[model samples]
Every structure is written in C-alpha cells, then in structure tokens.
Target: MNDYNYVVIGSGPSVFRFLPGMQGSKQRILVVEANDFGGICPNAGCEPKIFFEGASKISLLSQKLTGRGMANPAKIN
Candidate 1:
C-alpha cells in the first residue's frame, strides 16, 4: 500500500492554488479527480450563459431592424 501525506479529491482551482506552497516539502501528494482534470469559469458556467444571452439579443435586434437599415433585403452587400 502507498501512503500519501496529502490527498485531494477535486480538481477545482481552490485545491490547485496550494501547489506552490507545497513545493519541495518532500511529502507524498496525490490528487484524484473523476471529472475533467481542470476547468475554467468562462468555459463551463457564466460565459456560456452570457454567450447565449448575447445571441438572443442579436436575434431580437435583427428582428427589430428587419427593414430599417437597408431598402432591399435581397440586395444586401
């Protein structure tokens, strides 16, 4: 059996922040994660929501300006 001085379960950023302080301590460390190794806020949570909202807003703006910007929709350049 192997012994670990430090065992962290999640891959979240909070746990990773401790890595710098643990350097050269000569202690056995283990990190076990069942999900993706690392995650970014913009990749998973708030950013996607913001992206979808932006798309929805663009759609709404397009509908509102359907014939306002150009005289002929078929002759767009």
Candidate 2:
C-alpha cells in the first residue's frame, strides 16, 4: 500500500500557506482535493456574498443617480 507522512485534505488558503513549509522536507506530503482548490471562501460562500453585496450597492447607486428615491426603502411596517 502507498504510504505518506502527511496528507492535507482541504484546498484552502491555509493549505497554500502550509505548502512552503513542507518543501524540501524528508516526509512525503500529499494534498487530496475533492473539488476546486481555493475552498468555499473563493469558490462558494464568501465570494458570492461579496458579489451580491457589490451588486446591491450598484443597484442602490443607480437608483440614487436616477433620483428614483429608495427602491423599497425600509418602511418599518
């Protein structure tokens, strides 16, 4: 059977940071990624959140520029 001294499962920024330390080391290191690298922050959650927030900001800005008056302004109803 194949043997390795270290196996890192997730492919996130932390993994990238840790990779340099493993270089030139005697221990065999293996990185196992089941999906896209860079993890959920870049591939799913955080990035999408940022994108949606930016879109909302742009929509608000456009409404303000056109003097449309807050499109769904908080009504406290």
Candidate 3:
C-alpha cells in the first residue's frame, strides 16, 4: 500500500484552500468524501437554500402583483 503525507477528509472549502499550496509538491495526498464533491455549502447547503428562497420570493411577489400591476403571475419551473 502507498503512504500518504496528508489525509484530508471531505472536499470542502478548506480543502480547496489548502490544495493550492501543494501544487508542485511531491507529497502523497488523499482526499475522502462520502457525498457529492465540492462540499455541502455548494451542493445542499447555503447556495441552494439562497436560490430556493429567492425563487420562492419572486414567485410569491409575482402572484401578489398579478392583478395589482403585473399582467400575469410568473411561473417557476
């Protein structure tokens, strides 16, 4: 079996930040992630939540203004 000088758990933001410095090094490195790559913040966390909330807000605003000012309610699909 091969040896690793660094064993990083999860390919999260910190891992990304740490990798740039190891660019030309010959040290063996291993990164392990059980779920989708790029971590939770981009996959199932803050980013997705922000998009969902923004869409929902826009949809609701469109619904509310459908007759008041907007010609039609916006549909989210």
Candidate 2 residue-wise lDDT, 1-77, digit = tens: 88898899988878889888877888887788889978888787686668777878876676666645554533211
lDDT of each: 0.71, 0.75, 0.90
Q: For each of the candidates, give the backbone clash count.
A: 0, 0, 0
Candidate 1, residues 1-77: lDDT per residue as tens digits? 99999998876677779788898898888989776775555236567667877877767676677789944333212
Q: How many angstroms is residue 62 displaced in model 1 relative to the true structure, after the best TM-score fit? A: 35
Arranged by lDDT with the best first, the candidates are 3, 2, 1
Compared to the true structure, candidate 2 yields what TM-score?
0.49
TM-score of 1: 0.50
Colliding pairs, model 2: none
Q: Model 1, stretches more than 4 Å misplaced? A: 40-43, 46-77
Ranking by TM-score: 3, 1, 2
Error of 1 at 30 (Å): 1.0
Best candidate according to TM-score: 3
Q: How well is each residue in 1-77 modelled by candidate 3, as lDDT tens digits?
A: 98999999999888999999999999888999999999998787777668988999999999999889899888889
